[model samples]
Target chain A: MTHRTIKPAPNIVQGTPLDAKALKRGKIFLNSYAPALRYTWDTGEAMGRYLAELKNGRLIARSCRKCERVMIPPRMFCERCFRPTDDWVYVKATGTVNTFSLCYVSWDVRRLKQPEIPAVIEIDGASPGMGILHLVRKVAPKDVRIGMRVAAVWKPPAQRTGSITDIAYWMPINRRSQRTVSAK
Target chain B: MNERVAIIGVGVMAARPSSEHLSFKEMMFEAAQKAYADAGIDAHEVESFVTCAEDLTEGISIFDEYTPDQLGAVQKPMHTLTQDGLYGIADAVMQLRSGLVGLVVVEAHSKHSNLENPNSILNYALDPVYNRPLDFNPHVIAGLEMNGFLHATGITQAQCAQVVAKNRTHALKNIAAAYPMNLRAEDVQSSPYLCYPLRDAEMAKSADGCVVVVLAGASRAQPSKSRPVWIRGVGFTNDSPTLESRDWIDAQYIRAAAAMAYGQAGIKDPVAEIDLFEVDDAYAYKELQHLVALGIYPQAVAAGRAVENGESGAAGKMPVNVSGGSLGIGHTLEASGLYRLAEIVCQLRGEAGPRQLPRAKVGLAQSWRGVPTTSGAVVILGR
Candidate 1:
């Protein structure tokens, strides 16, 4: 779809940049407002049960009969199959690290002294490639690898809460053995 | 897809770290005025308007209510899409193609500097139950994805660094770019890791800017004084939003979007047919990842090697992000897609100034809604 060309027109690039001093000195009129909005999200049937299972030191997942894929963060319906999930299955706490990060910053961009190693752990009983996001702890950040095996470290029953945090974090399975041997 | 739609005019407020002097409305007005003038038509002539914005990012609920007055769109049919500006373009294109609207205006802007805790706002996008509770920073997702992508495709960290170096160097020639730099890939590699495997230098800093585009049906565009860039295809898609369910190694959303777009554009081979590209580079690795998803490269490793060998540079075989991309241009949030569209429009019209491609004809612009969201859009335009 070729057309007769007009000479390239000059672009209209307009914007005024300011420094911190400009705002501080009131050189530019500024209005500041902050909104504090609070929300209490409803954890639905699938996730509601999943969190409860976490509180009990177990991982729960839903299986899609149509696709035969077991999914975590269990949902009522299988998005791929467009069908309601058929059964709930308990997944093994031990899994391989599908991917991980050594996070040196907080959600608000605040620097942290100790890096948080967040990982996507593919639970053993779930379908291949299905994983949940959680922290991998008790191992040096440098030691974390994508394929390393890890198992969840759960809180004591007295301290159990219906939340993902009920499981403190995932630790390298090898490190768990080392700790057990050292304790013995 | 029924009738032809053409981009008659595009106006942009060059991206900056902050636009302290202009309010978002004022930026809109400025961009709209330029666009209307370039199109050689009054705002009154436009039949429909679409504004791309997110309420959380705007700090205003129902942000569409405030969009109309600024663009002379009062008492007109205007709606907002909580998506990237490329989606806005797609909306306008559909409106025009419907034969109901002869002309449409699309606008998207970023007031990113106004956000005090941008990362926290991004955190809100995560799944409240599963992911948000464990959130250190949402960018950890990027780190994990980069690591997974590298493992899956054998693309190295150094190759991703070269994407930063190439795009920043290209920004030097772009008058509208914000973070132009001339540095080696080592500079990016050595930069402190914000989330391990994802460095601070690899992420695009936020910028404030606005983009306005005017699109018209064949009847209106053929009679216009300005040259028109024809819209060949437009497509967008959203993959699974859940962290557990989605593909971490590739941008399935982008691939799906490109498939729909390339099919519509009759682009059997994107690498051979498209003259230039302005794909999302919110993060450096994203550039290579997107290239692979766009079907320009067979896989991430090939896309990575292409960057390493300077094959995607401004002067390379298939020039990608010659306009500096989000990396060098500063990420403008939702308006990013429009900024990419604006760059391609300028290049296709031979108006890119120093960064203009020599044989530009067909071009593609792609965008992704940043972290934790899998929504992405692609548009193809030909002169």
Candidate 2:
């Protein structure tokens, strides 16, 4: 049986569009309220250990005996293997950039005077492809590149706290040597 | 497989940047009323109801409580998915195919205009311990992924711009689209960069709208006023939420979701079997990335060339986002997938007045829950 085409009825959609100015000027009746919600997250066993090691100028990862993959921002279990992770592995404070972004806007969409370089650094001694998100600094934003080696810049021991911020930022390493080799 | 499901009715409120005159409930009521009328049935006939929304976005606790009244779903089996509308459709399809519900209704909406700071809300979606401390815009994730994807697949920045040019131009013919325009690849390339490699024009602006769809079992669907758009297959998947473990370059979530849908539909070759597609275009690069993941194009470079050559255009071999996609229609958050599904239904039923495709028998709709997450859903529809 051939069914005839079914068209939507006329004026089916009903909604009035308004601009930000009109909404602010009270051109339309409105009610506004802001909810203040607070949260306190518990950094679990693996993450707690990871953050603690960061304060001491070190990086730690958990290894899965089944997959033999060392993961950062350590988790208690291996998702792929569906088993509890086997051991804690200490990784180097230096690594290569897996990917990077030069952000020109703030979280609220406002343009920034200085672009922030956010990157995923694959830490040394961990399995390949395992990386953590962090900021890249101490170099021009344009100079940051994927696969470039970088070392962690840590805060003073007196100021150190159990947090990811214990390490100030990641900075490019062997820049002079890299430039000389490229020039050769 | 024992019973088939079909979409009997679809109703939508045309997307706009803001809808100050109507509350979310009013928007829901309007959409539901039109859908019921289109199906030639009343709300009471629907045995199950599913609404897609996030509590943070709605600014209300237990958002589903507000849904039942507007949809006339009071005292009915109703729940909310905190995911996109495509997931809601998948849920309804399962219910109908289970032989428990003869009729079902799925609804989703976006009141993004009400948000004073959407970025702040999106920030809460990040991992508190690992990612949230960075204090940067969540879209930087898109920027990072775009960089990785381009480097891995050899797709250029100019090719990404062509996506914006084609999708926006297509929106010019869609009355429901909010940001329709005639743009060139050069225009997008010259636009200010929000994040390096991700220009401001590349991202979709949020819009306010609601979509309500009425679905029924094979027996119940035959009596509807509108021609039934059969749900041949439905699939949804979520990859790792952690930034450390997930694949940054490839959209494995979309790949798995599409694989499940294709398998159920018995589709061997999606490029030839599907007539048209309305996939997610939350960002210009995402359209190309998703095309690669959908297996429609072999890789990002091939997808880019297809866009440049207009092979994905309205008249191309495989028409993609002919309804302007989220880029042109304005991203409707959770309602995005339903909007895409409604457009496909209109085309398959031959009711898409101006932007209709000729001999469109099969179509697909896909959606991704945007940034700071890896979750998506896919649905295939046939006439």
lDDT for each residue of candidate 2 in B1-383, tens digit (9 for 90 to 100): 45899999998999999886666766777788889888988777789999999988888889888788668787889999999999999999988888998999999999888877788888778776677777788899999999999999999899999999999999999998999999999999999999989999999999989999999999888844558999998889998868787798888899999999999999999998999999999999999998898898765689989999998998888889998998899999999999999999999999988888886999999999999778999999999
DockQ of each: 0.01, 0.01
Query: What is the Cα-based lDDT of residue B314 in candidate 1?
Result: 90
Looking at model 2, the pairs that clash are none
Rate residue A30 of model 2 by lDDT. Answer: 58
Candidate 1 lDDT by residue in tens digits, B59-120: 88899997876687877899999999999999998888888889999999988888877777
Put down candidate 1 lDDT per residue, A23-117, tens digits, no spaces: 89899975433334332323446767887897777889999998999999786656454345789999888889999988999999999998999
Residue B96 in model 1: lDDT: 85
Docking band of candidate 2 = incorrect
Q: Give the TM-score of candidate 2.
A: 0.68
> TM-score of each model's B chain?
0.98, 0.98
Q: What is the i-RMS of every prediction?
A: 19.3, 19.4
Alpha-carbon deviation at B264 in model 1, angstroms: 0.9
C-alpha root-mean-square deviation, each candidate: 26.0, 26.4
